[model samples]
Target: MTIYVNGRFLTQPTSGVQRFAREILTALDRELCQSPALRDRLGPIEVLVPQKVEAPGWRRFGLRHVPGGRGHLWEQGALWRASRDGVLVSLGNSGPLLHRAHVLCLHDANLWEIPQAYSARYRLWHRALRPRLARRAAALLTVSRHSATALAAQLHLAEDRFRIVANSAGHMLRLPSAPGVPARYGLTPGGYFLSVGNRSPNKNLRALIAAHAACGSKVPPLVLVGGEVPGIATQATAGGGRIKMLGRVPDGDLRGLYEGASAFVFAALHEGFGIPPLEAMQLGVPVICACSGAMPEVLGDAPLWFDPNDKGDIARAMRAFAHLESGKRSAMVHSGQKQAQRYCWRESARVLAQAVAGVPYQLPAGKQAARGVFGSESRPVENLF
Candidate 1:
C-alpha cells in the first residue's frame, strides 16, 4: 500500500500541530527504517509537502509539490487531483480528495464550537471548510477524547468515525538547559514563569496578564516564548518589563526555558489536547493551568488548577503555587512526570501507521473501544506496533 502523508504542517514552525506532525513523521520514518515488521507491512512512505520546503532529516522519502500556484485554489483543486493515486493522510485538517479513503487528523472543533475565541477570518474559514472536511474524511484522528466528542457533536460525525492519538513530549523533555545559555538571553538562571503559544484570545492571555498583575510580588515575571510581535503588539504590557516576549526561540533554547523556569503556566481556554503542559510535566516544572477544556484532562491533579475566566481565581492559584513547600513541589513534579509518561511519539506513530495501513480502523460507540485504545493501556497495539 502506498501511504502519502500531507507534510504542510511540518514546514511551519513549532506550534502545537506543527510539532505533532514533525515528531510523528520523524518517528514513523525511524520505525520504517529500523523495524523489520513495519518495513515489511508498510513498504515505503511518501511525504507530500508544499514545493520548495525541505525536511532535512527524513530518510527514505522526499518532497513533492501539488501542481499549480493558485494558493487555496491549488489546495482545493490541484492537490485533490494529485492525491488520487494513493491513500493520503493529512496531519492537519482538510485532505485533498473526498473519495480516496483519506484519514484526517482534526485537532479541534474550537473554530466551530467556540467561534468567539477565534478571529473573524478564522471563524469564516472553519465555517466554510471544516464541515466539508469532516464529511469527506474516511476516518478521523484527534489528539484527545474531548476533541473526538466535540468533533462528533459539533460536526455531527459518527462517533465510530474518529480515533484518539494523544500528543507526545518533544525530544527536549527531561533534557537540561545548555550551560550558561540563559545569560545570553539576559534571563536570570531561575527567574520567570514560562508561558508558550500565541496571544490569540482563546489562549486567554488577557486573563493571564490580569492574573499576573493580581499576583503582586508573589510570582516572578511572565516570559512568553512564541508568536508575532506585530500581531500581538496591542497585548504588550505598558512598561514591557514585567512581561518578556522572547518571540520564537529555537528548540534548544525553548527546552532551557522549560527546564529553568520558576514554574510553567498555561491559560488557554480550550485545546484539542494541551501539549506544552505535558512538556512542562516531562521537564519536571511545576505547572499552573486553567480548569476548563483539555487542560485538566492532560494535567490531571498534577498541576495547580484555576478558573480561567476569573482573574482572581487564577491569581489565587499562582499565589498558592508560589508558597508551596519543597516537598509539595517535588510531589507535583513526580506526578507530572508520571502523567507525561502516558503519552509517547512512538505510540502515536504506531496508531497513525495502523490507520494508514488499513488495519481495521473502527471507533465503537460511547467510550467502549475508545477507552480501550486511548485509555490506561500503555502497551502498543500489538499487531501494528
Candidate 2:
C-alpha cells in the first residue's frame, strides 16, 4: 500500500511543530535512501498537500507532492479519500478524525494545559477537536515524555497509546551560518543573549523582559526572534531598547544568532519539546532555562535552570551566566554540545519507519543502550539513550 504524508504543515510557516514535521519527513526520506531493506518493506511515500500553498522544499527530499484540496476541508475530505489505498500519516496534530488508518502526531496538549497562551478561537477549536481526533487515531505520536504524560492525563488514554519520537538539532547543525548575518541585524557576534519562540503569554516573555531589566545594564542585550504577536509588544516596550524584537528571521540569520549568542535563554512555562535552546547548544552556545515542563527533561544538565515565574530568580540566573569565568563558560558549552548530541534526526526517522512497518517501535541505539524509550529523570540522555 502507498504511504501518504499529510502536507498541511507545508501551508503554515516554520514553527516548532512544523520544524519537527519537516525534519522528520526529510530524515525519513534520507533513511529510505540509505537503507534498501527498509524501503522495500514500507513501500513508496508521497506527499498530499494543498495546491494553493507553496511547497516548502519538498522537492529536495524526493517527495512526490500530489497537490489538491485547500485547508481543513482537504485534510478531512480529499486527504482522507486519497488514503483509501494507503496509510495516511498526519504528522502535525489535526487530521481526519474518522480515518482509522491515519497516524496522528499530537505535539502537545498546550491548549488544555495553558489556555491563556492561545487565542480564544484557537483554544476553542483545539479543545473541541483534538480529543476526538486522539480517540480515533490509528497510532498516536508525540514529541516528549512530558507531553505524552500531559496528553494522557487530558485525553484519558493509556501512556502506551502514544509513542515519543523526540526532535533533533541536526538540521540547524547542517545550516551554514553566514558570518555577516548577525551584523545584518546590527548584532555583534557573542554580544547578545538570545530567545526565540512565539510571543504568547505562556512563553513568559514578560518575565524574561523584567529579568533583563533587573540585570541593571550589566548583561548582554536580549534579542527576541519569533512571531511578533500583540501580547508581546507591550511587555517588550518596557525594555527601553535593551531588547531587540526581530520577528521571524531567515534560517541563515537564525543560525548566525545561535552561533553568535553568548547564551540562549528560554523561559517558556511549557513546551512539547523546546528546540531553540537545543539549537543553541548545537552551535556550542551555553543555555539558561526555566526548570519547568519538558525543558529540564529534554535539556538534562546542560542549562543553568531558573524559576520561570520569578523575575529575580531569572535575573540571578542571568547574572550567574554572565559572572561565569571563561573556563566555566567553555565547560557549559562543551556540556551543552554533549547533551545536544543525544538527539538525532535519523534516529527519529528509524522510529517512524518501525511505526510505518507495523513492527514494534524501538528508539535507535545511541552511545548508551540502557536508556528507556524516554529517558527518566534519574538517568541523563547520554546514559539512557
TM-score of each candidate structure, all chains considered together: 0.89, 0.88
Candidate 2 on 50-146: residue-level lDDT in tens? 6655555543233444445666777778888876565678888888866666678999877787787777766777788899998877688899999
Q: Each prediction's Cα RMSD?
A: 5.8, 7.6
Clashes within 3 Å, all models in order:
0, 1
Tell me model 1's lDDT, rounded to 2 decimals: 0.74
Instruction: Write down the worst ten-residue block by lDDT for model 2.
Output: 376-385
For model 2, the stretches where C-alpha displacement exceeds 4 angstroms are 52-69, 228-240, 359-385
Candidate 1 regions exceeding 4 Å error are 97-99, 174-176, 229-239, 359-381
Q: For model 1, how big is the CA root-mean-square deviation?
A: 5.8
Question: How many angstroms is residue 186 displaced in model 2 relative to the true structure, after the best TM-score fit?
Answer: 1.1
RMSD in angstroms, candidate 2? 7.6
User: Model 1, range 1-385, lDDT digits (tens) per residue?
Assistant: 4567776665555677878888888788877777676565665567766666765588866567665654355556666666665567788766564535578888987776557666566567657877787776767799988888888888887876787888988566535567466667778867888888865567888789888987877888888877742212224433275887787888888888787788999888888898888998988898999897877777788999988889999999889988999899999999999999988898898888777655224322321222222233332434645
lDDT of candidates 1 onward, in order: 0.74, 0.79
Candidate 1 has its poorest 10 consecutive residues by lDDT at: 363-372
